[model samples]
Target: MENSLNSIFISLYAQRIQVLFAVIGVTITCLVLYCYRKRKPGICGNLRFSKVAYNSITVDWDRACYTTHYRVFLRKPLEGEKWRSFKTKNDTCSFTIKNLPINTNFVFSVCACNGTVQGPLCKESEVISTQNLAFKMKGISILREETLPNYIPVYDVPFRVERNGQLKVRKVTIGDYPKGGAHQVKSILFVSIPHSGHTTHLQGVMNFIFGVSTKDDFRLGFSSDITKKSDEYKNWATVYQFVEYEGGRLDKPLTLVDIPRMHGPKKEQLMMIHEQLKYILELYEQRLDCICFVGPANSNNLSPEEIDFLESIMYLFPNDQSSDLSTDISCFFTFADAGPACLENGLKSSSVKNFKSYFVNWSAFFRETNEFSDSFWNMNIKSLDNFFNHLNASKPKTLRLTLEGEPPAPQKKENVWKLQPEVKEDVANLQMTKTNGENFIDNKTKLTYNLQFFVYNGGNQTN
Candidate 1:
């Protein structure tokens, strides 16, 4: 009996050992399959063009499965030619190739990537040609309407003047007197950061000048249809156009809509803003004839970095405050209170008081009239005047425009398209130097790059 019991126990132990071995064999097989099985990122699909601009083309593609990112290759079709590789984040489906040589053809291809390893080169590719449309061809001319409306449009009247060698604000006035009166006005946009009282002060100016209280009668928002609202609002609606930005808001300012979400230091944020501003200016270039930049004195609470950024913008577009009649855009730097008290105390006490010496001799545009107290409009006009002096010194030669009230002259559209003179230099560098096979800049590098191209061009290049 004891021998039979021992035999049973041995049989059970052997069975258990065999089952454990079987489980281990299955696990090992799975592990081997997972390691060696094809781990390629999904194949790239149709590459298409979303937009073709004067010096750039926006390329888009269908996202590949399991792709951590996409690698872009630019090739100038030739025998045994290698592609110029670029890259975009996995979530980014489109990339804009900027600073491209005009009137040239290039083939573009995309491949999926898994971490550092890229999948097979996409079989599908797209052929694109860059063209300088702004320079090569004339845009369709828009006709101005001949029939005149009965009401005097606010925009018809220019509110810019050269005062004591500074660019100063003029009272918002009618361009002409109404013969059979009951005037009409067109749309106007008040561009400024919030809490500087630009809206409230502009309201006072409009009411005093127009002789009717339309303080609450304006539309608020950015719109492509400023001309459409002329008939609806008659004339007063134009003076009430105020688009608000920044003031106790955690969200981004409306002016920063074109900029991408940013990380890193404050300087990075300013740089991105600068780029987006350039893009915005490009989009509205042709339509900027009547545009104005109105910045109030109290809004001068700009940080040193912010001041530098603004100064760069002024250098890029010095004609922002051009008083020329044929000017495409004008910049208006105003005081918080346009009265006498603010004028004296302003230059001496404002946040920009220390830096007010920069704008000394430019035109001084004021906001106060007889209806409002000169004391009520307390602003640092002198400091602002000095500020314009500095602007005059740093202003670039290429950006200068013929002053308004002076003769109209031919100006190059290229200047508007090119934000800075260095763009050409950067492009020339890219073409002159041949990239070795390791031209691909890894996504991890915390480097600033141009919007259209991924290559580093020394310091940060504006859009």
Candidate 2:
């Protein structure tokens, strides 16, 4: 009797457990179907934006629980630009119409969904049109002027060491071969610009200074930082720093060569740099063979005479915003040829009276039948080797005008024409050339460039 009773109890308990599990599974299935069928109608929450456009507000939707994508529609509130939509086979719930012109009224709607079904859009999100709305742009970042063409050099600054503990150069953050020289010191300038070239030169210097000779000493500068501008300069040459401080970063010299014309920098920036060099040069004894200016070579900022004095060191690197720092400053006021390296045998650029500015048409492309491509002109100095014999800082001006573009009007016959308000070049400027071969000194006292402006239409003979 006891055995029979025990068997009946165990069977009843097993049946109850099975029924309980069955009920729980059904409940879960019901919930899954409810969520799937809910179509997940995303929240528009009445489209919102930082600002309203014309009469419309932006649309926003929730992307939660979405598998595939979303869709956006714009309407004229009634018959607008015809339900225009953005395809979103993927998941997205937000869309912005950035160029929605000003002073227009429009309505926009958006919705999101799973691959199986789409949830209904809640409240058209936001209706937007930029009518009567005050269009105020957000704050924009103003880049430092250093970011411009006058690129600053990269740096690998040693903890500003001193001869007797006097800091010769400030701790900072810091290119190429070139013409005309003496003593054959086998000197290669590792230069630095205020912003660009310094890093490269520093790296070059470090490798040589701590290379095989001090192979084990490499661990010292292990903590020293070097950028590309400084890396190329290691050990090959001495470095000097001239920049003081501009917003904490070094304030490298400004040059006219990069600016090209008065449009380059404000009249004040020229004076600022002129005064800067005047003061900076005072720190050093005029001795180094080359005062490697690792900076831009354009004469738009510096005068022809000023640049000649700077190059009085050696190798006459056309651009060396990257000044050097070395104990031995021996060579001073020596001339190594500083003209265009590629232009040695022939003229590279021909001036054209085409645009208001003197259009320098390079001969390498025109004469060689080389099709000019944008990428070609963007190359470094080596890429430009075929065209420059080294840029002639004091080359005589010959207006080589192309017969293309607008028809040549005959009213202009002067060799140099004054620039008009519409154009950037000043054609009326006098043609100034350097006198006294290697010792050209600028007595102008003013930090201004005399652009040898010329009239393209008329020959110099008439002007």
Candidate 3:
């Protein structure tokens, strides 16, 4: 009986050993398979998304450097939503699971593939418990260096969209007038004409005459149009024609509209300038000796004909305040054009007194002519501060037609259509190098000067 029992026990023990080995073999196979599976990143990029309530989630690898295809699988709730697994290639780094009914937690992992070859899924996908993941979102960080000043309008959108929105914005004038006007009854501010000197010169004169700005602005002018209402409370104080926009100072910000107008020609450029000068004269008409102010020589860009034409304008509106701001205004002449230079270019005849410079003493012109006063430094006159001085001494009146009051009436329709003279040539006594002195210029500069004046004065001058 003992022998038989021993045999049975031995057989059973051997069976048990075989079964244990088979189980170990299966476990090893499963471990190897898990190790070989590949996966991909479930969340992508440095950007933060808005808060939302969701179960399963996916991501895109559209950033630089990543090229391999991936398959994603979520383990449990990583933080926010309930996690779930999904499939995607390198081409499709994004996915959407159709069903995620429970609010269970999860972890996610991605599997990378190279077409024929499959890789292992990532280990321990992050937890994404729907209950634990809060719905609230954190605020995003703003890039301070990239943002514009607080005063300017700003919005969060595509760059193009933001640009369009800015274009549509209308300025809301604060503190005072939505539209401002020229302060005086008349003004004589000079606006830029073409082919003028560089901004360095113009700006220097502008600052000297206008003074440092109290507040830098796009322009100094009056309202474009104002229709006075019977109800003064409702109506504006004054209406004015639009003048040239002054533009930003040397150091300041510029708007888009200003950007082009400052550098490019506008439809109303010439007209606007004319209107500005006219407005200024109107504002300070009675306050000064002259209603007009002309910058002498224009740094030598203007030709004799051009200067003569400018003088004629003085004659055209002889009655305008610009015509006479001097004492005993008749036979106008003065020492204003005297040159103090040691070496006079002897270019005096061009600076002779005329009907426009009528206020200046005729003797002054003769003296300067004899001396050949050519340096602008010596010839400049002290500007008349307030025309009141001359106005008080001699109550000057608007110069009326001393000659044919009304020029011969226009001929007819055909005559009206004939090109009217916009600019007049200086056709007067032409002198030799003696009184007027000869024009001094090298070949290159002469051509440049000639072409420039021709465009403006049509090649004309007067002695």
Candidate number with greatest lDDT: 1
Pick the winner on lDDT between candidates 1 and 2. Answer: 1
- Please report how far candidate 1 places residue 362 from its true position, in Å: 44
Question: Top TM-score: which candidate number?
Answer: 1
Off by over 4 Å in 1: 1-38, 124-126, 133-463
lDDT per residue (tens digit) for residues 89-189 in model 2: 56755565655644455666666666657656545644555632111110111222222232322222333322211211222211111123211111122
Q: Rank the candidates by TM-score, best first.
A: 1, 2, 3
TM-score of 3: 0.22
Model 2 TM-score relative to the real fold: 0.23
Q: Residues 306-362, candidate 1, lDDT per residue (tens digit)?
A: 333333333333354552322222234454343232232322221221222211111
**If both were scored by lDDT, which would come out higher, candidate 2 or candidate 3?**
2
Candidate lDDT values, in order: 0.41, 0.32, 0.31
In model 2, the Cα lDDT at residue 365 comes to 18
lDDT per residue, candidate 3, 1-463, as tens digits?
9999999999999999999999999899888555443322233332221221334344333332222455555544435655454556444556544334233544555555644354544454335543211110001111222333322111111111111121221121201121365322222222122333212222222222222222221111111121122342121111121121222111111111101011123223323323323432343342223332222222333343443333333333454445431212211122224333111111122332331221111122112223433232122212222232332344333323333322222223432233122112112233343335444433568778777877787667633
Worst 10-residue lDDT window, candidate 3? 132-141
